[model samples]
Target chain A: MFNNPVTSLAHVKTGRLRALAVTTAKRASSLPDVPTAAESGLAGFDVGFWLGALAPAGTPRPIIDRLNAEMVKAVQMSEVLERLGALGVEPIGSTPESFARTIDAEATRWAKVIKDAGVKAD
Target chain B: MTSLRRMRCANDRLGGARVALVAAALFAANVAAQQAYPSRAIKIVVPFAAGGPSDVMARTLAQRLNVAFGQPVVVENRTGAAGAIGAEYAAKSAPDGYTLLLAQVGDTISMSLVPNLPYNFQKDFAPISLVGQTAFILVTHPSVPANNLRELIALAKSKPGALTFGSSGAGAASHLAGELLKGMAGVDILHVPYKGRRLPPLIC
Candidate 1:
């Protein structure tokens, strides 16, 4: 039942499927009326699908910075914003350091969740 | 005869000098190419099928980057292993700036879920800017009769193991969302995992 808004939003609009809640900290802009899981009684439920760009390890820092600058600028462009918004995605242009920290934090959090839930890749 | 020998030596020295100059020129050109930081086409590898959210996002960025850098920025779909196949490929590629991976939450989670993965997500890749993020929507068939999250939790509670939720894959973000919901809500909904991001026709 966990589906992306790209494929599921149309269904929710047409009433083919009922969206119970979005699994994120805030309400999805595309579906402003639908409550987030936390708002709907699951106090701390927050999950989201994020996309980040990555280069192989040892890529030069200057190159990384250049790519980062272009990415930050790209995400802010009105055309890119419109394209991403149609998919129910919120653009986030972050520093490489912050992105690295996010990866580390998410890895740590999901590691615990997978271990506790006994989840395995098939 | 002595002049002939001297002439041969002079020719040899000139040839050697010419070769050294060419070698130095080529080396400098290579360095300049490297310093240019994308002298050729840049590839963005998406570890998913074409037309999915990840691919879409990658393609969108690729188009913009192609214009911004004045070089071809293409999106390559290297689908398999719930994103590990493409991830491993990107990780092992030359550490040049041309190759990049469109990474997602599942890539990070795979660090723990899949054993013997060839590459480490944290160790093998350098983070760039985060493009965007989308939330997963918990939806159900109209027949299930759950109006909202609370109602759905209650229904799952009453029915116990009867309710089923489907995800894109076993360790995908969708599956983890389901697990989180189950753990936090303390319900026992059966998890049905499909092969790709697309759910079974009946569920959607």
Candidate 2:
């Protein structure tokens, strides 16, 4: 079964489920002992479930900037950091430009994967 | 007759001036409303069901945003159609900084798989800061013999169509992750997709 660390970490920790590997480029901080898929002999096997913020396209730039500033600050807060960290989630408070770039890159990367694998919407 | 024509022209000019004044006043009011952002509740649309990871993350951010802006920041779950419903709702909403979508990687993937989606992911949304990322762990029931990814791949290769992996749903991140693993490992393991948030225990 493939599940995010938030829901599956406890089962993995308690020995109920045997974690084969994390499907991310970096090893999870909470499960440092577990090897990443790439390290486990599948090179370039990076698949992370990333979350980001977005508003409608016509939203003013100033408002977007304000939201970004507050979000970046909030994610870095000690309480937020600790809460996310325990679930093996990495806090990334990136600028809007960088986030847009990530979205573009991910869209391209996953589109090819879906096409190659013949994945259809259900 | 000339005086009557002059009087009509004067009335037309007066009407135009009144129209301009009202337009200016409305524009000013709109600007004032925008400047005082979050004058009312700000909603974050989570495309998934409540108590899911996306919802949890949105609520976490909402709490902080509420405190920072001194206005209510709410998380609205608009779940359905593998997150398309909420995404479309957010996309068509007024771009006044009050409506936002807690977007996930699934949304980007849906662009390729789901055809004729109402809004384009890149064109309809403005990117904001990335919140956080969680790694998906591939786990198996304790009874499986494979201890690592390599062993599991070998096991699947040996018993090609016999082993099956379960996912949260069709076209979900988990399902795609399973597909990626299949493509990378060059194995023929079957994919079993479960519906909704409840995932049955791994049977393979």
Candidate 3:
């Protein structure tokens, strides 16, 4: 199974790649017409995909700040936003502090999911 | 001479006020250091193989960074260990602003799936920004008899190990999601991981 709608939707948007449900609780902005996983009967299955830019732990705070500011600017660009939207990507551009908190929370969340699923690296 | 007098006056300030002055000076120096830091090429290491989601994202940002910084921003793919090798390399690299990392959710999943990892994400990396998000989509070949999630579960139950699935690789998010589906659905489907696709769940 392709892990994201971008590839799946790209492969065959109409025939084979019908998006039955998205993992988000709400409908995906890119695929607003499609129903959510919960709406499709898989209630509470809200797994999501997120990406971040990170520097080494001791990287200068100013550099991190500059990077974050530029990224925020990039995501807000109309062309970038349009491309990302079409690819089923949501531009977050959140603060470094919040991004750190998100990583912490997500690490914990996926750990539980993998643990409960007894998922082992084959 | 005037600056020296101002420094003396700042030193004369008491307790919290003096501490604030010292902190302000440190912050200015830090900013100055960072401003002049990335005069050379900056590397954004993609832990996954080239052409993957992370790599594409990294490349996009690299282009933007090149324009923003007026320095060539390069994307280096340090693939392997399901992204841990690259992540560890990035973590251990000099804390200088020259090197950055484009970390994906797969890397986070690896934190749980891979034990005794060389780098602790929280400890080793400082997040700059959440670039974007992508959702995992579960798909089946049209030839498969099952049409929907419920039917798929019923079919897998009747067939047991007859259902086989594929993933990008072992320890990849899709593989884990397959395991999760099996556990949640309670059926005996086989998992076949590859740099390919197709995953099965014995849906019960």
Candidate 4:
């Protein structure tokens, strides 16, 4: 019915991207890099998450460690990973150590951008 | 003797006053504590916005639960960043079970999509029964003139960078699905994003 909202289909249902790709492959092999007039006219969009925990400076490390450990285990189960992949998603399954590093890097990246652009969240 | 009688009268009044004050204070404290967990009305925090499947499910569930709990279990919409606002509110609530959250599969997706959410779905929330899951049909715009996936692929390949598709937004399942299609089919379907539900027959 050409019924799906472009944004929800594009962003929220990202997991189904893999299956969609398989289907689209049978229809057309090559497509455009930018939205067509018709595509833009539709209402569908999404944004990815880059932020995480923001506890007070002195929160215990043990708590973070335990949570991250559980998260890794939950994300790594074969059923979970397969389900995520089938949804066109790849998991990081990172440890607190790695997650900390990514968090630091993200902070640095965003800090620089904020400094350069003078961006502030209201 | 007259002074003594006056002092006794004053003492009786003072004692009566003190007793009344203490009793009033205790009553107030008990009432404050008993502010009825479900007080006036309760809100079930549905992570998604109103009108979506999750929202609908939550509202319907809230209605049924309200019937059982004998309180107005209102469905509050706190949509943003893919249910983060709703989840965070539920996590920070008084663990009294009055402020409930309706979580779905996207709970996991948000962990990856928005890595730094304030709350953890598994930790912050007590395990509630799993809701339901919905399977979607992979339909395309009829204007594409592709009868099947094969024809669609050929048309896309022949006119690479010429065709486009719509997605809810970046990192959304629909968006990722489009990206996956681009990556796997080796086609470059341009993605157009929006900020609403992707299902058909929307109420504009």
Candidate 5:
């Protein structure tokens, strides 16, 4: 449990734990001064706790696009940004294309990592 | 003119009028259907426990979407199997755009970690947008002799398999990240899996 809002919600913000390295390419908005894993000598380490919206595969394109636009608009709202910042989460309003790519790439990368590590699910 | 030809011409003119009327009716119905979309409540399914970031984010977005759609939007938490249960629930749900999933990275992680997952991350769902990303921080106990990634690797190498880290589970992001560190740095640190995410002492 580190600075992930998903894991350290009650701890990270309270400064009970200090960050030695973050697993993103850049510094977290909540902890700007903290260096990234790349900066900390492990180059190309860019894993993040990401979230996205998804619908059933047969969902209409119009509905999918509408949801994407609405999500993008919602995330860009100043209030939303402020709220996410308070929670140590970075607001990303990525398009479906980019989000799909991210999902694929992350899964592929993590798959290889898991295979290499011999990690299994509980 | 032949009787058949006369009837054909007359019916052709009638057919033109009928086609125009039907086309207009269809256009109106299509517009009506489009307008009717989201007339009902919208549900965003969270694949994790309540009070987590995904649940909170979905709730916030649900509030905004409710305001935008002028329909009640709700957040439903379906916790199990590290989010696959909720994802499958959303995947098998009606494709009417009423039910959605607030998916997380764990969904994909489970694809590689969990065998025979209920749904395919890429195939079973249509991607909407990446709501946000949480940056994972690597923190250590004050007593652990490491200040940064390099230092941590060095410390692990100094005592092979002596340094142990805890993750949410065997196939969690934290666990994979630790394994990645070992592969990248060539260090031997044992990975201990926890039932769920917890603070260092509790996890260890």
Candidate 6:
């Protein structure tokens, strides 16, 4: 089913997303569609990734684990998360092994997409 | 009289040679200045539109990096096709550390998003330490009176396929974030695509 506002807001006068829609419309009327400011609350969404930091495919496990431990410690700090959030950044702290798997997976995924799309280096 | 004229002519030729020597010395000094690493200025490429988050971050960071390096670090925006235009330009730049790319998540994701990109992220460039990362949050337009994420989801669920979320574009992170919210919240919000940046601005 589709519950999107551009489609649904016309129907519900009392919906929360609808309420936001109203406020956002009012805000836009006062502001330019694209503001010169680099960071503004007008755009209230965070969308990006912080994948695992990878080394050579065969790098030793000990070093990888140590790096992961350091990253985990850094990301776990409440202050760090808050700062990242303020900048619209999400913090993802995951295991080295897991991160490694994700990196490999993403690499393969993109490679296939490129191949399928007939994308090549220019 | 002939001898005096010859002497004068020789003197003039020697003076001309001295002037040539000084010119050569000045040219050498200028070459020396150019050869000096970061002797004058540095440039950073922000492969995104100006006034966007990444561009702002790059400028801010460039200021700090400039202070650290004792040189002027300038930010140049080369926005197009997500970030391909900037990345391609950065790759073609001098490998000298003076010219660097202030790449972020979008640049990396472009590898997956932009098929058959001309440059390889891993091959053409080096990863300087990551500056920082921005996180995505699920915010509804303030029009919806449901406070917090739960109520928003509940309200959307009550009206399945009746809600919509604006995202930057198809295949963008915001698009995925909306999709992820749909999957996790089990609420279907139609995806409204915007031409530039994130979708939230266009929706409002």
* Count of clashing residue pairs in every prediction: 0, 0, 6, 61, 0, 35
Off by over 4 Å in 6: A1-122, B1-40, B141-145, B154-159, B196-204
Arrange candidates by lDDT, descending.
Answer: 2, 1, 5, 3, 6, 4
| Of 1 and 2, the candidate ranking higher by TM-score | 2
Q: Estimate how well candidate 5 is docked, as a DockQ score.
A: 0.64
Q: For residues B1-204, could you state the per-residue lDDT of candidate 2 as single tens digits?
A: 999999999999999999999999988977787789878999999999887768878988999999999999999999988899999999999999999999999988999989999999989999998888988899998899999989999999899889988988778888889888899889987888888668645737
- Kindly report which residue pairs in candidate 1 clash with one another: none
lDDT for each residue of candidate 6 in A1-122, tens digit (9 for 90 to 100): 11222233333344343232212112222122322111332233323343223332332344334334544555455765554444444445566455445444555644453444333332
Task: Please identify model 5 stretches exceeding 4 Å from their true place.
Answer: A1-16, B1-32, B202-204
Query: How close is every model to the real structure, measured as TM-score?
Result: 0.84, 0.85, 0.78, 0.46, 0.85, 0.52
Task: Indicate the worst ten consecutive residues by lDDT in candidate 3 chain B.
Answer: B195-204
lDDT of 4 by residue, B1-204 (tens): 999999999999999999999999987865554454335565677767676756655554555555544778788788886778888987887654456666654455455556478986545555333332332224554445564455666777888887776645554544554454455456766655555544432111
Candidate 5, residues B12-127, lDDT tens digits: the string is 99999999999999879766765688889989999888888898889889989999999999999998877888998999998878999999888888888888887898899899
What digit string (tens of lDDT, one per residue) describes model 1 on residues A6-93? 7899998998888889998999999999899999999978899999999999987878888999999998999999989988899998
Give the alpha carbon lDDT tens digit for every residue of B1-204 in model 6.
999999999999999999999999987865564455456676778777786656665565555546555778788898877778877887777654456665654555577766688887666654433434433334455555564455666777788877776655666654555564465456766776664422254222
Instruction: Give, for candidate 5 chain A, the lowest lDDT window spanning 10 residues.
Output: A1-10
Name the Cα RMSD for model 2.
Answer: 4.8
Residue B81's lDDT in candidate 2:
83
TM-score of chain B of each: 0.75, 0.78, 0.73, 0.63, 0.79, 0.67
Docking class of 2: medium
lDDT of 1 by residue, B1-204 (tens): 999999999999999999999999987866776688687999999999997778988998999899999999999999988898999999999988989999998888988988899998999999998778999998888877778889888888888888888887788888888888899999988888887446543332
Model 3 segments more than 4 A misplaced = A10-14, A82-88, B1-29, B35-37, B142-164, B181-190, B197-204
Over 4 Å off, model 4: A1-122, B1-42, B69-71, B184-186, B196-204
Judge the docking of candidate 4 as incorrect, acceptable, medium or high: incorrect
